[model samples]
Structures are given as structure tokens and as C-alpha cells.
Target: MDKIMMWVMAICALIGGVDQLAGNKFGLGRRFEDGFQLLGPTALSMAGLICITPLLSLGLEHTIVPLYRILHLDPGMLGGVLAIDMGGYQLCKELAQDPAIGRYGGIIVGATLGCTITFTIPVGMGMLGEREKPLFAKGILAGLCMHPVGILTGGLMCGVSLGKLLFQSIPVLILAILLVFGISRFPDGMIHGFRIFATVIRSAGTIGIALGAFSYMTGLQLLPGLTPLDEALKVVSSIGIVLLGSLPFAEILQRLLKNPLEWIGEKIGLGRNGTAGLLVGIVSALPVIADMKRMNEREIVMNAALLVCGTSMVAAHLGFVLGVDAPATGALLAGKLTGGIAGVWMAWRIMK
Candidate 1:
């Protein structure tokens, strides 16, 4: 599976690179460029956190571990509070008693649930207009309702038994329920809370980077277990490399699926903007969010739900998994795609 994915990425790179050099008539070149362009932002968001995850894990072990263990859950499940790229994998690996559970928690749970809480809710609310916020919240609530399907599917793919998966997911389920209630009942407050959460994460990432740089330059260990700045950056670089191919491949896939998606949208009563948003959101959610003004209320709500687990699946999330855990790429795809589609279906029923 790893070899096949590598080959696929290599082929994508070849095509993207050639298209870029040959005047980019196909526009795949832009996506190829986007991969590199993402490095700075990605590093800003995650590299620092990665460097300090070992230290964080130690603290978690002392504080959160006992309670989780008492509940018969893996401590690694706590790491799913952060996005996959933002130290979730490192923390999970560090805290896990069971390696399989760690991988399932960090990659599968983190990408969907963690990403939604840390990235999607805050960022999505901040970007949309006031009128759209409530609609977006409704969509997110719907998505949250269906998130377990994705997590369960991904867990099974990671070789976790259904019973074990459910057992370990107790905390996650509780937190998710809280989130749903918060978004549904207190949209404004939840938006504020998510923004503050994102701010705190960014602040922590910045501090981690500063400390890592200081440790590296002075050859003095201020923090005993800090991951080297260089090593953290290397992980970021690997993800970037994978993106070089994933982005262009996503572009190609979008182009091929464009007509079929439109046809499906027509039959399903989705607007043109909704169909376009679904396709674009796979590569990145920013564009779709930016263009929400063109969509009707139903489209806006559906998109918000879809993007909860679906955003960047074909691009950023895929690249991250392929770079970090190549074998889990299939699981990530299955979890995210199915979870996202389910969210859309649920939203349709709710709207009806």
C-alpha cells in the first residue's frame, strides 16, 4: 500500500512538475506551487507544537492519564483534541499504551474531530458573515452528529475492534456531545470559545518555536525533552513534499468529477454554488467559505456540514497522512470521505 501510494504521488509530481515547467496550460502547476506556499503557514501552525509535544505528553501522563486509565481508555485519546498536523500524532505516540490505538486516535480521530474543533469551527465562523454564521453552526452540528461514523470506520481500518474502539471513545463522544450542544444552543459563545482556543494554540506554537530555536542555537537544553527544531521542520517538509503531488492530483480529480458532481447536485436539489463548494472544499475550504455569499441557505448549511470532516481531504489531510503514516492513508480517506458524505445526507434530511 505504501509503495503504491508513493508511486501515485511520484506520478503526480512528474505531471505537476512538467505542467509547471511547460507554461502551465493545465493549471496543475498552480496547485504544485500551492504545496510549497503552504510551508510557512503550516510550520507556523504546527512545527512549534511538534517540538514541545514530548514535554506536553509527560504533563498529560501525570494529570490526564490516571483518569483515562481508570476509565479503561488509552491516554492517547486525549491527543485528538489537537489537529493531526498540530502535534496530535506526536503526543498520541508519546502517551499511548497501545500503538494501534495511538495511530487510530492521532490520525483518524484527530483529522476529523480535532480538525473540526481546532481549525474548522473557529476559522469558519471568523470568515463567514453574521447572517451566515447561524447556518454554518447548524451545518456543523449536523456534521458532528455523523462524525462517529468516520471515526469508527477509521478505527476499524486501523485494526481496532468495534468494542475496543467504542470503549476508548468515551471521552471523545462526551466532548463531541458538548460541542454539539454548545454550537446549537449558544452559537455566539461557542464561536468566541473556539477563537480563544485557536489563539491559545497559536501562542503555544510560537513559544515552542522560540524555545526550540534558543535550545538549538545555544546548545543548551532549556527543556529536557524538546524535539530538535530541525527534526520538527523535517516533518513539516515531508508533508510539503507530499502536497506537491496531492494538490495537483486533487485538481485533476476535481476537473474530472466536475460534470458528474453538477449532475448529482441537480438531481439532489443542490445549487451550483453548493456543488462547486463541495469540489473546491476537498482541496481547501478557504475558497468555498469565501464564496458562500453566492449560495442559498440550504447550500450554505450543507457546505458547512460537508466541510466538517471533508475539508482538504484530497489535499492537506491526505498529504499529512501519506507523509507521516503511509499505510493509514487509505483509512484516512475512507473515514473522511464517508463521514463528510454522511454529514451532507443528514443535512439534507434536516433541511427537508
Candidate 2:
């Protein structure tokens, strides 16, 4: 089922890319508006359990578990992830505004936040045990987590009242729609906010896991207030890992994928390589031709075509090597490679 959904998402990306290449506009009345339309649904739906089920566990812990035995607070988990996504978004946005950093901040921040926030839902859901419950509790929990205090702060700056705006049931529904739609229409906007948050919080789960392993290995307890220095060091280490490790990892992938067409040209016959390359380059390069940074739609087809061939070949090669034969793998690889190229292109675009 998971694999099936993955393929579905890939297909949507392919279709969307093709549409952009053909100069077709989505019903949303914007060229880039449909960018996330399909993938967002699959991600959110698959992550539904995570967003809602935690509330069930929280409720059960308070009602059933002995006070002395209650070891965890679910709110902290929800709030923490929300906070991380928020912090990463803010940090990236700030760096993007800097002349020295500019768009470099945006890519690092956006990718980290985007991947984390989207990945969190599924990861959280998987951590749960079977227990079905009412939707009200889930809805309320989802609202709170989705609109953490920091998100509200930013929304307020944009004239959106996170509390009052999201409290009403109708408004909540509207916000849900917007959240999904906004993902597609302005993926970077969503990522911008999430990245800043992720960077800030750095994810408590990640910290907890690290601390647990460290404690086991060094025979040191990880209790709070016991070692402030240790906690601070851990935080610093995580930050360094993200900045030096994660960012560089992405860069390495980009470098590895460079001249993907040339790689395919070497592997496959030239004719097959050329056809595949043309299709991918046309689709993948839309962001460039569309002038996505400032938001323009003209010249997108030609520019996107070039990018698609060059980068989509990377995805195809990735799929080939991974033995990914599903239609979805094709779509995902196509989208992933395109995204990588888009990131590099955006970086170059901003640099110039």
C-alpha cells in the first residue's frame, strides 16, 4: 500500500510537469499553483494517523495510566515537531534575506524543513499502536500541532489570526484545505516556514534518541537539569551536523547527479537516451523557464525542457540502480531529480 501511494505521487508529479511543459494551466488559475497538489494529498493522508493518533495516546495516558507511571507527555511531542518546523522556516527566511547568504539560506532551510515536516507525519503515525477513536479529539489535536504558537506569530504578521482563525470548525476545515492547497501553490512558502521551525527546534525525538544512545554508551544519565552543559553540547552538535553534514550531503548528491544525461548517454543507446533526456529536461526545468524566484510563466517550456533532460536522467539512473520498476518510482525519481536541479538552478539564479 505504501509503495502504491509512492507511485501515485510520482505519477502526479509527472503529469504536472508535462502540463507545465505544454503551457497548460491548472484550474487554480496559476501555472505553478498545482506544483504540490497531488503529492500533498498522498503525504497528508498517509500521515493522518500521526497527526491524530497522538492525541489518543495523550488522552489514554492521563485517564488510564497511573500518575507515577505516566512517563511521557504527548503535547510536548506534537508541539516540539511543530516548533522545529517553525524554527527552521524562520531561520532560513532570515538567511535568505541576507546579502551574504541570500537564496542559499532558502534552499538549505526549505529542503530540511520540507522533508522533515512531511516525513514527521508518517514517522509519528508509525510509532502508534492500534486504537480507533473519535475525530473531534483528532481534529483539535491536529489544529494545535499544525498551528503552533510560532506559526501563529508569523501568520499574524501576514494578518492571519492563528487562534481565532483556526478555532471555529468551519475555519479549521478551510485552513485544512488551504494547508493542502498552499502546499501545491506555494511549496516554498510552506517550506520556508517549516524549515525555519525545524532548524530552531532541531527535533526532540532526534535529540532523545541521541541522548539515549550516548547515555547507554557512556553510563551517563540524560535527565534535564542534571547536565545543562551536556544538553547544550548536544544541541550544538546537532546544529553542526545539520549545517555541515546535511547541507553537504545534499550538495554531494547534486554534484553526483551533474551531467546525468552524459551518464545515461554512456549506459543506454544514444537514441533511447536522447528521447528520455528530452522528456525529462523539458519537464524538470520548468522552474527556470517559469522564473519561479520572481514568479513568471513565460519561457518556462524551453527552459524546463533543458533541465528535465539533464536532471530527470539522474532520477532514471537512480531508479535503474535501485531496481525501481514501478511507475511511481519513475515519477518520484523524476520529481526528486527535478527538485535537485531546481535547487541548484535557484541557487545559481539567486547568485546571478
Candidate 3:
């Protein structure tokens, strides 16, 4: 019965996509009923988010671990993460600057917080009394600013502080930044793989690389270990880690900061719950993001906002992986996921 209830919720959440469509419908709704006018960038962003889940699920299990261990210098693995992060951040940042992308800032604001709260806070809760816990949190954030969070966590696990590590990483960070920038400049046509169905194939390629590395280095003798099903979840989880960790959770945060009222409003039951519902609606309304709003521009903005909030789950989940124990990642993930999706839906009803 518990499992059934969860399935029911998931299904209901998925179906919220329809609400988005309905919201956009002519004459009676928010304003932008004709869904056909949705922005290409927004649609592309939606497709990218949806596509990554399945792709990550497909192949990383067999590849990533071995590759990372073997080379002990897996630039490809790190580079892939950086490329995706930089591209998405740069794109969203640019979008935010455009008045066209500015209106739906609320959704983006929600999504960013969702991912951050989900990933980071839960980890924080666990480390409350632990002597080493604070170090871990500081390490993770500092690492994000200085190096890949994973590597930084790995370093912190090795007992190094960011100040001690930053000088050593200057060369690497500069290189990573350049690599990401270069990838971003790829001919828009070449990069359009994110749009094409074949892009899934491309994404899975990274998984294959990562898994192959993991297995070869570990020397795991089990035959079943190489199977696709065996690796699917782990691989997908890691890509998810990268996505949740890398997305513009902070920028979304900046936008939210811009509006202090949300803080006061939350006291009256209009803040967190409202944001969660909006996110729930976003996941449900992917196929028809434009339907969630009456204005075309607003619809596009809403979709971006939703994507940002959706990333909270990743942020919270990462906290767990980073080793913060007390405020467990499990609790944070659940709370944020619930809050993010619920927030969006609530916003829809209340605002309308």
C-alpha cells in the first residue's frame, strides 16, 4: 500500500503537465493559451533535462568507475561534467539577462533552491555534532568554486583545506574553464545533438567511458558486473549528481534573494509549499510547458524556473554522497522534492 501510494503520487505529479496546458489555454487562463508559440530555447532546455535521465540510465555503470580509477587522471570524465555544467549555466545566465527569459524567473528561482536545498542541507543536518562534518560542507562548496566537487571531496577526505588546495588547482581550474568555454563554442549545429534523438546516444557514450574505466581498474571478476542492467542505476545516479551539482542553483538563488517577500510569504503558508507545487507541475507539464502560462514569454520563463528548481533533488542528494551524516540526504531529498513540486502547483492555484 505504501508503494502503491508513492506510485500514485508519481503518476499524479507526472500528469500535472496537463495542468500546464490548461493554464495556457485561451480566454479563461493566465494569458498565453496557444502553446505553439513556446520558445525554442525553453523547449530545448526541457528536452535536455528529460533526455539526460534516460541517457544516464543507459551506460555509465559499465564504464565510469574503471576509467576514473585506471587513468587516475580521467580528464574526460571531469571534462564532461564541466562541459555540461558550463554550457547549461552560461545558457541560463544568458537567458536570465534577456527580458524574454526574465519573467519566468520565479520558476527558475524555485528550481535552483529546490536543487540546492535538496543536495546541500540534508548533508549539513547530519554533520551537526560531528567534529569533521563542518569541514566536509565547507570543502564541498569550496571545491565547487575551486575544483570539481567530487575531487574536492576526495581531497578533503584526504585532509586538505581549500586555501591549501587552491594554489595547486589554479592551473587545473583555468584549464577546465577553457575546456568548458571551448565546448560551449562548438558550432551550434554540432552541439544540436542535445536536441536530436541521437543525442541520447551521445550522452550514453560518456557512461560507457566511465564504466569501462571503473571495471578495468577494480578488476571485479563478476561477469554480471559488465551487464547494462547492472550499471544502469549507478551510472544514472552519477550523471544526476553532476547535473544537480552543476546547475545554476546559486543564480536561481540570486533571483530569489532579489525578492525578499517570498521569505515573509512563507510564514503565511505561501512560500515553500507554493514553490514545491510549481515544480510538481513542471515535471508533469514538460511536454507542454507553454500551457502552464497565459503569456508565451511567461510560459517560457516558468519552464526555466521549473528546471532550476527540479535540480534541488540533485543538490540534496549530493550532500549525502559527500559524507555529511546527521541531517541525512534522504530527509532533505524528500523534503525538497515534495516542497519544490508542491510549491509550483500551489503557485498556480493561488496566483490564478
TM-score top scorer: 1
Model 2 lDDT per residue over 1-352, tens place: 3265334434544544455566645421122233323223322221222222233344534663343134321111112122122222223223222321211111221222233343322222233223211111132122223322222222233232444323312322344456546544564466456445444333433444455446657877554322222433333332322222222222234445556754644443333333332333423322222232232221122222233113323222222212212222333333333444443343224323
Listed in order, each prediction's TM-score against the native is 0.98, 0.24, 0.29
Residue clash pairs of candidate 1: none
RMSD of each: 1.0, 20.4, 17.5
Tell me which of candidates 1 and 3 scores higher on lDDT.
1
**Model 3 — TM-score against the truth?**
0.29
Model 2 poorest ten-residue lDDT run: 131-140
Model 1 segments more than 4 A misplaced: none
Cα lDDT, all candidates: 0.89, 0.31, 0.32
Residue 176, model 1: lDDT of 92
Model 1's lDDT to the true fold? 0.89
Candidate that beats the other on TM-score, 2 or 3, i.e. the better one = 3
